[model samples]
Target: MKIDWAALGSVFGISLLITVALVALFTLGIVGLSRRERAAAQGDTAAVAVTGAYACFAACAAAVGYGIYLIVA
Candidate 1:
């Protein structure tokens, strides 16, 4: 059997990028929540921070759900 080196490399590249993106997104969510806590301690309204944190979490969840769906289907 012949190995399809180009296809293998392409899949590897895509997977690597997606993994990095997901990790970065999760990290941003954590950082956003941490910033929100700091802002609260300083008595500042963390409206933007709160929104950002939630949005990041939601996106991560959606991505995970979609991956599961793809696997199942």
Candidate 2:
């Protein structure tokens, strides 16, 4: 049997890129939370930071859900 090396490489590359992007997105969310905490400690409003963090988390969740859907369907 012949193996499709190019297809295998393409999948591997895409997977690695997506994995890194998701991790980075999650990290941004964590950073936003940290900023919010710091702002709160200084008696400042952190509405934007909190909102941004939640948005990041939501996007990450959506991406994961889509991936699962792809696998199942």
Candidate 3:
């Protein structure tokens, strides 16, 4: 069977895009967590909690996106 270079290229491109997106999202989560920790150390409970929640949400969103990418790709 002949190799389909075009199809391979498309898959590679999509995979790269997904990987970059995931990395960005994970980075956001890490940043959020760092901010939360700093706030907690500063005695701002409310701000710390909010930042923690946002980080959790970001992580969840990244996981969902990865699952969808795997399914479609």
Candidate 4:
């Protein structure tokens, strides 16, 4: 089968962007979680927003990987 280089490149680029964004968001969530955990331990009122952020990041990252796999295969 002939490979469409342009389309492959576009898919790869999009996947890379998504992966990077997910990682950045996950890192931010981790930082926020650390802060929130500390606050909670100190008996402060910090709602658990980071957990949802982390879950979303995981889903996004998995989707990006799946897209990359589809493009490659």
Estimated TM-score for each candidate: 0.94, 0.96, 0.65, 0.55
Over the stretch 1-73, how does candidate 1's per-residue lDDT look in tens digits?
9999999999999999999999999999999999989998999988887899899999999999999999999
**What is the TM-score of candidate 3?**
0.65
Best by TM-score: 2
Q: What are the per-residue Cα lDDT tens digits for candidate 2 across 4-54? A: 999999999999999999999999899999999999899998888889999
Give all candidates' CA lDDT scores. Answer: 0.93, 0.96, 0.76, 0.77
Over 1-73, each residue of candidate 4 has an lDDT whose tens digit, in order, gives: 8999999999899878876887777777677678778888899955666666577667767877887898899
Cα-based lDDT at residue 8, candidate 4 = 97
Off by over 4 Å in 2: none
Q: What is the lDDT of residue 63 in candidate 2?
A: 99
Q: What is the overall TM-score of model 4 with all chains considered together? A: 0.55
Worst 10 residues of 2 by lDDT: 45-54
Q: Could you tell me which residue pairs clash in candidate 2?
A: none
The parts of candidate 1 lying over 4 Å away from their true place are: none
What lDDT score is found at residue 73 in candidate 4? 100
In the range 1-73, model 3's lDDT, one tens digit per residue, is 9999999999999879977876776676677777777877888755665666587667768678878897999
Candidate 1 residue 33 Cα shift, in angstroms, is: 0.3
Minimal lDDT window, size 10, model 1: 44-53
